[model samples]
Target: MELFAALERDDYEELLFCQDKASGLKAIIAIHDTTLGPALGGTRMWTYASEEEAIIDALRLAKGMTYKNAVSGLNLGGGKTVIIGDPKKDKNEAMFRAFGRYIQGLNGRYITAEDVGTTEEDMNIIYEETDYVTGTSPSYGSSGNPSPATAYGVYQGMKAAAKAAFGTDSLEGRTVAVQGVGNVAFSLCKHLYEEGAQLIVTDINKEAVRRTVETYGAKAVDPADIISVDCDIYAPCALGATINDDSLPLIKAKVIAGAANNQLKEPRHGDALHGLGIVYAPDYVINAGGVINIADELNGYNKERAYKQVAKIYDSITRVLEISRTSGLPSYAAADHLAQERISMLKNSRSTFLRDGHHTLSRRQLRG
Candidate 1:
């Protein structure tokens, strides 16, 4: 890949490749922007098909984190790390410790946390080598698994979307088609079930589906058939690019709100959803609860305060929808606009250097 050209195109700050032959660690760290503060994001461990694919994923996710943090009102920039290996087979204490040392070498330019294939235990291991990791166990005085908090934020965002589309936020009796019943979606289904929302859930993992069905009485369906299912809200708690050309035409849901990232295959997909009168809770805006929860650790973790901040996701969704209506832009575009405006404003407001201290590197320094 043309690394410099890609970074220039996306306005990325820095991208680092870390390799530890002894521990079999091959990782890519992408810091998209640090105008707000140090780049704070999670480290995802996955089995990528190729190194190029891993780089692309890291770059895209890092850019998304910048927007997510900015829109969520956090004084942080965006960054992401991807470990290109099978998490099930490749993870080890030595590998994570080696990775943590690489993070420490960055001198606080990026803070890491648990993501996808990684866990709180992994964060604890990383913490042993560096103090720049969040989302560790309660013993470390950090927020525990962020999935539950993320689910809560998505649930609240879903209700906000319902209010926008159906004139009421109460999901009672509403049918929601959940695309995946992973850790976050499992908790989300519990919330939906308690609120009297009928659930139609699907997942590649049959055991996960079975567990959700047994616990919440969710109706299980084939994964491929989920988009066409009749439902009020299509909650994609799985991976990205689900709302592509093929599934867009078949989606029967009035609202699309879920915990997934990069749900739109392309920018045009967001326009297409808008044309269909679908209320889309911008993925980054709605699913930032995990980041929000973890960011609180920087200020000394407080569950109550963190949850209170997550509840404001509803407000963020409402504002995004309002921007979409007033500006005649797609919801996703509106969210980007809102985040960009804040970033620009902050960049100008904080242009002057402070004598006390600086939490983030200068833009020029970050670019280097």
Candidate 2:
């Protein structure tokens, strides 16, 4: 890959390549932007097809963090680290410790958390080497599991999307079709159920489906039938790209809100949704509760503060919808605009402040 060109294209701030032969640690840390504050993102471990693939993934995920944090109103920038190895077989204390040292070298320009193929235990290992890490064990004052907080945020975002679609944000008596009854989705379903929303749930795991059905009195359906099911809202909590071409046409839901990442197969798909007048809560913005929860660790891990920030996702989604309505842009595009506007405002503010400071200093020197 043309590494410099790739970074330059996105105005990326920094990328670090760390290797430790002794522990077989091959990692790439990408810091996309730090205009907001220090970059904060997770450390993902994946067995990649090639080194180039790993680098590309790290860069992509890092830039995504920048947008996520910006839209979520977090005073942080975006960064990510990809460790190229088999998480199951290649993980060792030394490898994580070495990675932690590298993060420490950045002096908190980057903070690492647990991500795909990584666990809280791995985060604990990293904490041994530096304070620039989150998702550590609860014993370390880290927020334990992020699923419940994430679920609550999604529920709140869903209401915001519903308000944009329907006349009101109330989910009472509304039919909500939920795809994937996982940890986060289960909690989301509980919120929906308590609000008197009827649930139609589907999952590949029969046990999970049975559990949701029993717990929430939700009706179960085949996974293939989920997108086409008659419902007012479709909540995708499983995989990404469920909003692709095939599923888009089958969806009857007026509001699309979920905890999935990259719901739209592509950028154009988001435009398609806009054309259809479907209110979509952009995935990154709505699903940021997990990041918000972990980020609380930076300020000493106060649950109340973290959840309060997560609840703002409702306002964030509402802002995205308002921007779309006023600007005639797609919800996804509006989300991008929101993040860009925040970052640009800060950048411009700092530039003007510095320029004025220079002038004031020159005038003072002349008087002296």
Candidate 3:
């Protein structure tokens, strides 16, 4: 990829490449924007086939974070980091500490958390080197794991979508086709099951699918057949691009809401969903629970306050749908419009500042 061209096209603020030979850590950090505040996002570790792929992933994820934070009403911008390696095999204390040092070097232009291949334990490791990390273990007075909070937020958003599509917010008799049964989805399934939603679950991991079936009495389906299943909601808890061309034609769900990031393969797919009268709870808006939970750490993590913020996702989803209906735009476009409007207003209101002064400082600085 032409790196500068991509940055220009995406309006990214900064991108940094970090290499540490001693720990064999090679990572890319992309800060898409800090117009709202300091950039904050998660660190994803994946075994990409090429450097270009990793760069693209970081860029796309960073931009998504900007939108996610903005729409979620956080005083933060968007940034993301990608460590190009196998998390299972390549992770070592030295590597994470080295990565943390790089984050610290930014002086809190960016804050990192856990995503995908990374974990709260990994964030704790990063915390050992710098304070600009969230999702650390509760022993450190942090938010701990964010998956359950994210799952809860998605559940709330799903209920909002259900209200939009089925004239009620209850999932009591809804059949939901779940695309993946990972950690967040596992927690999500529990909520759906408690609400008496029938689940048809599929995952690349057969063991995960089997466990969901056994635990929740969810029906098992072939992974490839999940999109076409007759269901009230299609919940994607897996990777991005699941709502693209092929799957769009097969989806039978009236409501689309899940924890996945970047669900649309392309912008047009969202339009296609809107054309079909499908209610789409924007992925970032629905999934902001995790970030909301983590962002609480910045103000001295409080579970009650964090959960209260997450519960507001229902209202946010309602507003997004209202925007879609009144403006005749896809739900995704409506969400973008809302977020961009916030960013623009904030940008104009704070025009005099060259720096946003939203940096995350270490405990020492906080104490001082």
Candidate 4:
């Protein structure tokens, strides 16, 4: 399980790994390419089943980031970090600082922000050890939590997806079923309500569901029932890979758009959605708002610039639609094609392209 060989299989030239003794911290960083710009992505903390799973996740996620940045029209290329452990039981101040020290060692080959199982407070701890972190506490005058921005971007992108699917950009008179009521989903619900869209929401947290019911009058159902609910748009604000085989047959929505990562069970799932006539917003593209906002903060926190950049999601989505319609390719493939083209352009210009499609990755595989 050599990551560099896996990277080489995909034509990625730069991959780096780091570990920390202070907390038994294990981290992997895969930079698909810096030809576009510095690699920027989030840091994910999860109790992976194995080191091989972590390595596979990091490699795939980093590659996704490249395509995500390219399609989002950002100058940054994609990269990702995964900390292998149960964040709940494995996290501590020393652990974060030790991890931050690893990030500092990168010297900028990779830049990180918060991801699943990591929070703004955790990022602040990392910040205490390194300048390479973003999405810190608001007291630091940074953007703090990114859920609002993420949801806003997803909302905007969802509207565009709705337009492509239903022939109108207005969310008015639309019924959307969302599969999570976390911070991002909360904001997304507000966006839908503001746009005259009715909401059907679900979550494991009773308090979150009850509060949403009390405030927005959203219909609450069990998490399992949310997907099968009949609706215009299905928004997934939870974790990735929710739209796999089991849920695919149950989905009653015309458009599949969500802020969750890794929404597809597999690449072929995108084709299945297309076959079902579902207007799918590729997860990496629609959900990139958080990364986009944090990437802007990388140079300096620029609220206006960040918002302006997020608006491009509309065009990015439009391009996805165009590719899907004209070439009959799945939305995911279209987005990947766009990113691959950009990498090719960069590689030709600088004479430094990593392998693109299934060559090999050249890093040591981690085992949990």
Per-residue lDDT of candidate 1, residues 277-366 (tens digit): 999999999999999999999989999999999999999999999889888899999999988999988777666434336565665689
- State how far residue 98 of model 3 sits from its true place (Å): 0.3
- Every candidate's lDDT: 0.95, 0.92, 0.95, 0.85
- lDDT of prediction 2: 0.92
lDDT of 1 at 181: 92
lDDT of 3 at 73: 96
Q: 1-368 in candidate 3: lDDT tens per residue?
A: 78899999979999999999988999999999998888999999999999999999999999999999999999999999999999889999999999999999999899999998999889989998999999999999998999999999999999999999989999998999999999999999999999999999999999999899999999999988999999999999999999988888888899999999999999999999999999999999999999999999999999999999999999999999999999999999999999999999988766644366644554457899
TM-score of model number 1: 0.96
In the range 243-270, model 4's lDDT, one tens digit per residue, is: 8889889988999888888899798888
Per-residue lDDT tens digits of candidate 2, residues 51-88?
Answer: 99899889988988999999888899999999999998
> Once superposed on the true structure, which residue ranges of model 1 sit more than 4 Å away at CA?
352-368
The deviation in Å at residue 259 for candidate 2 is: 1.1
RMSD per candidate (Å) reads 3.5, 4.4, 2.9, 6.1
Task: Give every collision pair in model 3.
Answer: none
Segments in model 2 whose C-alpha atoms lie over 4 Å from true places: 47-50, 86-90, 203-207, 358-368
